[model samples]
Target: MKALFVAGTGTDLGKTHVACALLAAARSRGLTVEAFKPVVSGFDPHAPDDSDPARLARALGRPEAWAEVSPRRYRAPLAPNLAARLEGDTLRMDDLVADCRDWLSTRDVELALIEGAGGVMSPMTDEATNLDLMAALGLPVLLVAGSYLGTASHLLTALEVVRARGLTIAAIVVSENLDAPDLDQTLALLRAFEQQAPILSAPRAATWDADALVDTLLA
Candidate 1:
């Protein structure tokens, strides 16, 4: 199946937003899509719908078991590994990979989008990070970043590291952040620095140019 991993430079940096947009766009184009948050922290059992996986479920329109969307969940709003440890539970990279692969391998899923929990370097398990999981899955990454200050440094750093591992960066989506710099300048800087992958701007509270963004990836 055609798949993309929505990876962020850091947490809450618009991974889910981009993924949801793409999911909606792809569905509009008559393609079957499935998404997985896989391992999520900061889960509140009381408000189950207030979580990332639920957002994904809403976008996909497949309301079934939450575990199918997110196998490992922790209540503490911390890194998955730390949260898992606090509950005396372990998160194995093998298990994480298996869950995502199973979702991708489903025959009816024409496209799969796996959303990462934290930044690329964030630990998913005590021994492995999001990067390791990406490497294991070997899916093209649609790296997500924010248009806030210091984003250039973080985006460039993430781009370099993902490239260093010989992984294909499908594209970079710079989501608008509160108190961000000039959006045009940020996009220009990113394009000048990295010509290989297209950079798509995701403005906050504005209509997204979903057509171009989805077409680029589906290309």
Candidate 2:
């Protein structure tokens, strides 16, 4: 029941990409792996192609059903709490934690990757945030960030918050952003926190060895 929560510095920061890479690596080693995105916004169950849950389902070799991967979904492409409100629904922090625990109890896998919606501090419910959920789960975090101009600031701010909450950070994966500066510069900017945790880079549109990333994470 080894689990890690894939959290991002901001929306679309390659959290799913990293999660899928880890899932693929785990599967290659013949390890049973499961992925969950307990809450998602801007998801259409009927159209799984553009949704995070579908991507996770495909990575895990499971059917692309929204209900299977993400228990709660809202069609509005906004924060979970706001999206839920738009759909005339409400999300309770306790219920969200309960659902996650229930799902984890049913899975017997070598690794389980739970992805949070939006950024780490994004509101999941009216009274709670993704950070609260991560604290409740009590699992190590795999923080994902983009290699954009302001990424260094965002990453450092996230690191500070994560540290303040006393959460274990398994690693930090900086996904190359095409609009950002060169990889070397971005890496250099992040090097300041190298002593904090293992910092890795994910090339954009390049062939990657998922197993290598997995090895680093497990190490």
- lDDT per residue, candidate 1, 58-142, as tens digits? 7787755465788788999999999999899999999999988877777477778899999999999989999999999899999
Clashing pairs in 2: none
Model 1 regions more than 4 Å off? 63-65, 206-209
Model 2 spans > 4 angstroms off: none
Query: For residue 150, what is the lDDT in candidate 1?
Result: 91
For candidate 2, the lDDT comes to: 0.87
Go through the candidates in order and give the clash count of each.
0, 0
- Deviation in angstroms for 50 in model 1? 1.0
Q: Per-residue lDDT for 67-172 in model 2, tens only?
A: 7899798999998999999999999999999988999999999899899998989999988999999999988999999998999889999988887898999989
State the displacement of the C-alpha of residue 216, model 1, in Å, after optimal TM-score superposition: 0.4
